[model samples]
Target: MKQQLVFATNNPHKVAEIQQQLGDRYAFLSLQDIGCTAEIPETGRTLEENARLKARYVVDHHGRDCFSEDTGLEVYALEGAPGVDTAHYAGPQRNAKENNDKLLSALGDRKDRLACFRTVICLVQNGQEYFFEGKCDGRIATYPTGDGGFGYDPVFIPDEGNGRSFSQMSTEEKIAISHRSRAMVQLEAHLKKQSDVARPTA
Candidate 1:
């Protein structure tokens, strides 16, 4: 049987992306799979804090090894105005289109479009916690483009990409160089190390 690790998120997109990135080594469970209905509090002041909060919640309540992550789009010109508030930038509605519109409006007539996507993952296992971080430096597009990704994907263009927004790329293409994928690479490395240590020597 594959080992089970709960992911402290109900978002299918996030769970799917992570599972795809990490592969079939371990079975991944989402908050819904564990019967967790209460909205996990994310009142943390930073990405690391929010990720820790969610991971801790699963560890304390579900009594399982799990991980959680918080991602934000930081615009250099805006001085990171929407760092922690990336999801609810426009309002409590959490509307993606509105959020993108607001971001564009906020940068009206500004030449600088430099930005970056950052992800912080907190893994809690056997009462121990670890953090992994990843960043994708890029710039915001003058207008939203493509329709492939979710959230700010339509507007955020990765520097590594070929002059295209995240939404312009397929899932495989986006995950290849995404901030989340970068963080997951570090996490997978740690998990492998733990697995090796626990292996029985022949």
Candidate 2:
């Protein structure tokens, strides 16, 4: 039987991305599917802290093995202004277009557009917590392009993507090189190890 895990999120885009990356290794469910309607608070100072907060909330309230991730776009020029507040950089409204415009405006005519996408994943299982992290180096685009991805995908171009924004790439292409994909790879490996250890030695 496939292992069951709860992903502490309601974003269908995120759920689809993760499901594609993880394949058939585990069965995944979102908080809404499990009847969790309350907004899970993300009141941490960093990505790891926020991930832990969400994962812990799901485990505590739902009593299930759960995992959560927090992603950020850190721009060297902006002094990481949106590191922990990437989702609400523009305001509490969490408008993606506004946030993108704000970032581009803040950049102005600066030649250096160095930035990185970072993701922190926290898994809570059987009262234990595990964390995984991944980073993808890239530069912010002056204008948003493509419509295939969510969040900063339209304006963030990964170094390995051959100058194409994440939104321009197919889901498979993005999954192969995204920060979240890298973190999920590590988490999968850890879970596989744990499963092996728990198996009976016949």
Candidate 3:
């Protein structure tokens, strides 16, 4: 029998991406499937804390396996102003364009162009918690490039992936080198180990 996993997220886009990454090995369910309507408050001070909180919350409430992730953009030039508040960097409304523009403006006349994206995945199984982290370093472009990605993807030029920013690459390409993807690789390893331990011996 397959194990059930809950993805602690309400965003349709995030849910879809995670599903593709994790594949069919596990039975993944979104928050909607578990009848979770209460707002998951992000009171944590950092991405690592937030990710763990979400995963543990869902698992405790639903009594099932669950996972969650928190990602953030840290601009070296801006002293990481949006390090922990990438979700609402611009304002409470969460306008992607506005957030991008605000960051660009704050970085006026800065030639450093150094930045990084950090992602942390938190896993909760039977009340046990685990964490994995991944980082992608790159330079921020002076202007937006492609329209493929949402939020600040147009302005984030990854260290490798392609000449253009993440917004220019397809989903497959993005996942190949994304910070989240790296973290997911670690997560996959963790799950594989669990599967081995749970397997019956001859």
Candidate 4:
């Protein structure tokens, strides 16, 4: 049987992405699969901190090897107002559409629309913790576009695109060179090199 890993996340899309990214190396599991109902507090000041907090929580409480990741949309025009709070930027109660709309409104007259998506992943096993970061630079569209993807994908135009948004791209295309995917590649490589995945010692 493959090693079963608990992914500290409630989002099905994220879990699915990770499952595919891992490429059959291990059996994927999520917080809901293990009966974790309490919300993981995102008290960290940065993406790495938040990711480690969630990953460590799974291992510490669930007593299993686990990993977690946090992603954010950083807009240069907004001075990165929502870097660490992408999901709840418009408040935790609203959905993805609300969050995206607010972001576009905030950048009303800005022509540059320069922005990027960043993902910080924390992998932990047996008290060992490692952090990996991935970033994709792009520009924000004046209005949302396409129907594919989730979250801010509708308005995120990748660096390669002249103006097309992420929602218009296929899943394979998005995964091929997305911020989270790049970070996962780095993380998977690191985990392979180091047998011991544990929290850093002081």
Query: Scored by Cα lDDT, where does model 2 land?
Result: 0.93
lDDT of 2 by residue, 106-173 (tens): 99889999999999999998889999999999999989999899988999999999999999999999
TM-score of 1: 0.97
| Poorly placed runs, candidate 3 (over 4 Å) | none
For residue 17, give model 4's deviation from the true position in Å: 1.8
Q: Alpha-carbon error at 172 in model 3, in Å? A: 1.0
The pairs that clash in candidate 1 are: none
Candidate 3 worst ten-residue window by lDDT: 13-22
Model 1: lDDT of residue 178: 98
Question: After aligning candidate 3 to the native by TM-score, how far in Å is the CA of 170 from where it should be?
Answer: 0.9
Question: Which pairs clash (backbone N, Cα, C closer than 3 Å) in model 4?
Answer: 127-198, 127-199, 128-197, 128-198, 128-199, 129-198, 129-199
Better by lDDT, candidate 4 or 1 = 1
Residues 1-202 of candidate 3: C-alpha lDDT, one tens digit per residue: 6667788888776766667777787777888889998788788999999998888788778777888999999998788868889989999888989999988898987899899999999998767888999999997888999878677899999989656799999888888888888998898899899889998999
Per-prediction TM-score to the true structure, in the order listed: 0.97, 0.97, 0.94, 0.91
TM-score result, candidate 2: 0.97
- In candidate 3, residue 25 scores what lDDT? 78
- Write down the lDDT of every candidate, Cα atoms only: 0.93, 0.93, 0.86, 0.86
Q: What's the lDDT for candidate 3? A: 0.86
